[model samples]
Target chain A: MGNRTPLYEEHLRANAKMVDFGGWDMPINYGSQIEEHNQVRQDAGMFDVSHMTIVDLSGDKVKPFLQYLLANNVDRLKDKGKALYTCMLNEQGGVIDDLIVYYLGETFYRMVVNAATREKDLAWIEKHAAAYDVTVNVRDDMAMIAVQGPNARDKAHKVLGVAIADQLVDIKPFFMREMGDVIVARTGYTGEDGYEIMLPANQAPGTWRQLVEAGVKPTGLGARDTLRLEAGMNLYGHDMDENTTPLESGLSWTVAWEPEDRDFIGRAALARQKSEGVKRKLVGLVLEDRGVLRDHQKVIVDGEEAGEITSGSFSPTLGKSIAFARVPASVGTHCQVDVRGKLLNARVVKLSFVRNGKPCIDV
Target chain B: MSNIPQELRFTKSHEWVKREEDGTLVIGITDHAQQLLGDLVFVEVPEAGSSFKDSDDCAVIESVKAASDVYCPVAGEVIESNEALADAPETINNDPYGDGWIFKLKPEDEGAYDGLMDADAYAEVVAEDEH
Candidate 1:
C-alpha cells in the first residue's frame, strides 16, 4: 500500500478514487477525467502536488555548488526569488532528474524534485555538496498546491485573503515568497498562468478547501499529465530516463556551456556528445486521425522503425490525439504510429502542442 | 443500476449474464465495472458469430487512463454484438446495464449461471474491496 498524503481524507471526502503513485496515494480523478481536464483549460483548477519533494540548500557556496551540479547554468538567476528549471545529470551525462530550483538568496536555494526520483536526487546532491560545504535540508514540512488556468491567479488571491493576495499577484513567474508559513510561487506545470503554493502540511487541507470554496476546481494527476504533455514538457520516467541524456531528450537548450571550460558533472560527456553529433531527437506528433497515441508505440518512417512515442494522449484542447517521440535525427516531417497494429499517419512538428489553452502549432 | 436483476447472474470479474426468454444468454460488463473504468473512449467488442470458452476474453474497453478486457461469463457462441457502440463508446458509462451490453450469445450450458453472483452478493464484493 502507498503512503497517504495529508489531503487523503479530503480526497476521500470529495469521492476521489485513489491510486498508488510512486508510493503516494493520490487521486486518479473524482468522477470524469475529461470533465476535470476541460475544467482546467476553461477555468481555474487546483492540484495537490505535495508528494513532490522540496529541498532547501543553504550556506555560502550555494551558488557555485549549483553551478557545477545543474545542467542549466544557475548564473541566470540574477535576482533573488528567481527560479530556473534545470536537469541534474549523472557522471555519464544521463538525466538524473529535471527540477525547478528557486534562488531564494545569496545563501539559500530551494529545489522541487520529482517524487519518484527523490532518493537519487538527494544522494546526488549530498555527494556533491560535500566538496562545496553546502547544507541540504529536505522540507517535508511543506505541502504544495498548484492552482492553474486563466483565472487561477485571481481565485487564489481571493482565497489567500487580501493581505497576501496583492503581493502574490505581483510575484513574478518562477519566483516565490514566504508570507508566514505560506510560500507562493508564480509557476505551474500546465502551461497556464498560475501559482504553485507551498504551505505547512497541516494547513494544506484547509487551503485546498478554501480554494475550492473560492471556485477553484480540484484536479488530479490525470489532468496534470494531459496538461503537461500538451505543454510539450517531458515526464521524468517516460519521456526521458536514466538511460537518456538531455541532448537526446529535447533538453539540449537547458544546458549552458558558456566559457566552454567551467566543468559541471555532465559537461565533459555532453561535450563529447556534441562532438560526435546525435542520431535521435525529440519531436511532437499530431495524429491526423481520431485514435489516441500511447507510449512505446512504434513510429514508422518510410516503413522503417524511426522511433517510438514517449508520451501520447487524446488532447482535450485540440479535440485530437498528439504525441512526443524520440526519432532519428534524420527522421523528417512525417511518420506513422502503430496503434493496435495499424500504422496511422502523424505529422511531426516543433515540440510543444499547446500553451495557455491555445495550440502552439499553426493551423 | 437496479439490483443485479434476479433474472441475471454475475461473474467474479464483474460481467453480468442474463438468461434470455429463449434460454440463450446476453452478456455485458456490469455497472460496477463501467464505473470503475471512467469515460469509455474506445471499445473492441467480440465480433458476432465468434465462439468462446467460459473464461475467454470477449471484448476490450479502452478508457483515457487504462485498458481493460471483458471476459466471457460462460461458454457460448457470440450471436450478436452492440455494433452501435463502435461510434459512440461513452454509452457504456451512461447505461452499462442496458444499451451498453456488449453481446448476445447461445449458452452451451445452463448450469454456469449458478456460479455467478446475485445482486446482494455483488454489492458485498464491491464494498469489501473499497476499504
Candidate 2:
C-alpha cells in the first residue's frame, strides 16, 4: 500500500488507474494517456499535484538564507509573488533538488519541491537554516492543483470568484498572488499559460469538482511527464540527481554566477568545474527510425559510446520518438540510438521539442 | 471486468486466438491486456514466414507508460500481420477483439491449439491476478 493524497477519492471516482509513484498512490492517467496529453496541450486539464511538498521559510534572515542555499540568486525578485526556478546543490556541486521559490513578503518565502525528494529537501533546508534563524514550516494542510493548457486560465477563472479571477487575469508569468485563502500562480509545467493553485486540503475535492463542471478535464502524472518533456523541461531524478551537477544537466543557465563574491553552497566546485571545462553535455534526440527511444539506451556517436539517454518516449505532439541524452560535447546535429539490437538513426536538436502546442524544431 | 469473448481461446500471457476457416489462427492481445497497458503508441508485429515455437515472443506492444511482449500460444509459421496497426496503433485500445487482430499463423500442430485456455479458464487466471 502507498500513501494516498487528499484527492485520492476524487481520482477513484473518476475511474483513474492508480499507480505507486514515489511512495504515493497517484493516478497515472484517467484513461488514454495520449488523449490526456493532448487535452493539456490543446484544451484545459487539471493535475492533483498535492503530493509535492510545500515548505515555507519565514524570518528576517530568510533572504540571506536562500541566497546561500540555492544556486539561483533570489536577490532579483524585488516584487512580491515573483518566483525563481533554481537548483539546490550539494557541497560537491551535484544537484540535491530543483525547486521553485516564490517571494511572498520581506520575511517570507514559499518553496515547492519534488515529492520524492521531500524528506531530504526539508532536512537540507532545516539543517542549513539553523544558523539563519529561519523557521521551516511544511504546508501539509494545503493541496496543490495545476490547471494547464491554452484555455486553462480562463476556464479555471470561471471556477474562481469574479474578484479573484480579475486579479488572476493580470498576474504576469512566473508571478503569483494570494486571494483570500488561495494562492494562484500563473505558472505550469506544460509550457502553456495556466495557474498553479494551492488551497486548503479539505477544499480540494470541492474545487476539483467545480473545475470539472467548468470543463477542466482531470489529468494525471502520465500526461504531466510527457507535457514537461515536450516542453523541454528537465525532471529532477531522471535528468539530474545528487550525483550530477547542474552544469552537466543543461541547467547551467539557472546558476547565478554574477556578483562573484556572494558565496553559495557548491559555488567553489561549480567555479572549478567551469574553469576546467565540462566534458559532457545534455542534448535532445529525435529518432529517425521506427522504434521508440527509452531510458538507459546507448547513444552511439560515430560508433563509440558517447553517452546514454536520460529520458525518452514517443512524443504524441511530434508523432516521433524523442529523448534527452548526455553526450560528448563534440556531438552535432545527427547521431544514432541503440534501441534493442538496432542502431536507429536520430537527429540531435535543441533541448526543447515542443512549446505552446507547436513544434519547437522543424518537422 | 475486462471482456473475454466466449468464442475465442486465450493464452496465460493475455493473448486471444481465433481459428479461422482456412486453418490459420488469428491472434491479438486480449481486451484486459490492452486495458492494463493503456493506450498503445506502437505495435511491432512479426513478419510473415517467421517460424516460432510454442510460447515464443512473437511481437512487441508499446504504450506511453510501458512495453510488453505478445507470445505465440502454439508453434506456427507467421502467415500475415495486421499492417494497418503501423499507422493506427490505437486500434488495439479501441477494439482489441475485432479489428485489432495482430497476426495470423499456420499452426504446426493442430492439437496444440486445443491446449489453449477457454474463456472460463482464462477468466479464472485473470481473477487470480486481481487478488
Candidate 3:
C-alpha cells in the first residue's frame, strides 16, 4: 500500500482507478481519462494535488537566503503573494526540482515542490538554510486542490463563499491570497485560468465535495499529465533530471541571468554552459502520420537517430499525437520518429501546442 | 467481473476467438483486455493475406496511457482486416465481441480454435492476473 491523501476516501467513493504516483495512492481516472482531460479544457475540473510538498520559510535572512538558493532571482517577486516559477538546481546546474515560490512577506515565503522530490528538496533547503538561520517548516498539515478551466473560477468562488470570492477577484494570474487558514492561488500547471487552493488537511474532503456540488468535475492525474504536456510545461523527471540542465530542457527562461553579481547555486555552471553554447534543445513534435507518439521513441533526423522523446501523448483537444523531444539545436521543420521500428513523419513546431482551450499551433 | 460469452474461446494473452460458420475465425481483444487498456485511440492491424505463426504479435493497440501488442492465438493466414477501426478505434472498447473484431483468419489446422480456453478457464486466468 502507498501513502493516502486526505481525499483518498473521496476518490474511492467516486470509483476512481487508483494508481501509485510518487509513493501516493492517487487517482489516475474515474472512468475515462480523455473525458477528464476534455472536462478541464471545456469546463470546471478539480484535481487533488495534496501529494505535493509545501514548505514555509521565514526568519530575517529568508530573502537573502532565497536569492542565493534559487536560479531565478527572487528579487523579481516585489509584491506580496506574487508567485515565481523556478528550478532549484544542484551545484552542477542540473535541476533538483522545479517549484513555485510565493512571496508573502519580507521574512516569509512559501514553496511547493514535486512530491517525489520532497525529501531531497527539503534536505537541500535545510542544508543551505542553516548558515542564514532561515527556518524551513514543512506544511504537511495542508492539502492542495487545483480547480481549472474557463468556468473554474466562478464555480470555485461559489463554493468558497462570496466574502473570499470578493477578495479573489482582484488576485491576478500567478498571484495568491490568504483567507484565514486557506490559501487560494491563481496558478496551475494546465494552461488555463484556475486556482490552486491550500487549506487545512481536515477540510479537504468537505471542500472537494463542495466543489463537486458546484459542478466542478473531479479530474485525475492522467488528465493532469496530458493537460500539462499540451501546455508545453516540462515534467521534472521526464523532460529534465539530474543529468540534464535547464538550458537544454526548454526552461532557459526560468533561469535568471541578470544582476551578474548575484551568484546563486549552479549560476556559474549555467553561465559557463550559456557562453559555451548549448548543443541540444527541447522542441515540440506533432505526428503527421496516423500513430501515437510515445516517450523514449527515437527521433530520426535525416535517417539518423538524432534525439529522443521526453514526453508524448495523444492530444484529445487536437485529435492527434504531440510530444516534446530533446534534439540537436539545428533540427529543422521536419523529422521522423521511429515508432516500434517503423519511421513516421512528424512536424517540429514551437514548444506549446495548446493554451487556454485553443490550439496554439495550426491543427 | 467482465463479460465472457459462454460459447467463445480465449487465450491467456486476452485475445478472444469465435469460429465462424464458414470455418474461418474472427479474433479480437477480450472485454477484459479492452478494460485493462482504457480508451483506445489507435489500432494497427495486420494487412489482409498476411501469414503468422501461433502466438506471433500481429497487431498493435494504443491507448492514451501506453501501447500494447495483440498476439495471434493460433497459426493462420489473415483473410480480412477491420478497416473501420482506423478512424474509430474506440469501437473495440464499446463492443469488443462484435463489430470490434480485429481480423478474420483461416487457421492452418481446422481444430486449432477448439484448443483455446473456454470462458470458465479464461475467467480463472483473469482472476489470477488481478491478484
DockQ of each: 0.57, 0.84, 0.93
Cand. 3: chain B TM-score? 0.98
Worst 10 residues of 2 chain A by lDDT: A161-170
Q: Taking the tens digit of each residue's C-alpha lDDT, what string does model 2 give over A266-339?
A: 99999999999988889999998887899899999999879999999889999988999999878988999998
**How many collisions between residues are there in candidate 2?**
0
lDDT by residue (A1-363, candidate 1, tens digit) is 787778888899998888888889999888888788878888999888999999999999998999999989888988888989999998888999999999888899999999988898999899999999999999998899999999999999999998898777678888988888888999999899999999999999999999999999989898889898989999999888878889999999899998577679988888888899987889999998656788999999999887999998767788677889999999888899998778899999997988988899964
Poorly placed runs, candidate 2 (over 4 Å): none
Q: Which parts of model 3 have CA positions greater than 4 angstroms off?
A: none
lDDT of 3: 0.95
TM-score of each: 0.92, 0.99, 0.99
Best by lDDT: 3
lDDT, candidate 2, B10-126, per-residue tens = 999999999988879999999899999988988999999999999999999999887899999899999999999998999999999999999999999988889899999999999
In order, the interface RMSDs are: 1.5, 0.8, 0.5
Candidate 2 interface RMS: 0.8
Which stretches of candidate 1 lie above 4 Å from their native place? Answer: A361-363, B1-3, B22-24, B75-79, B106-117, B124-128
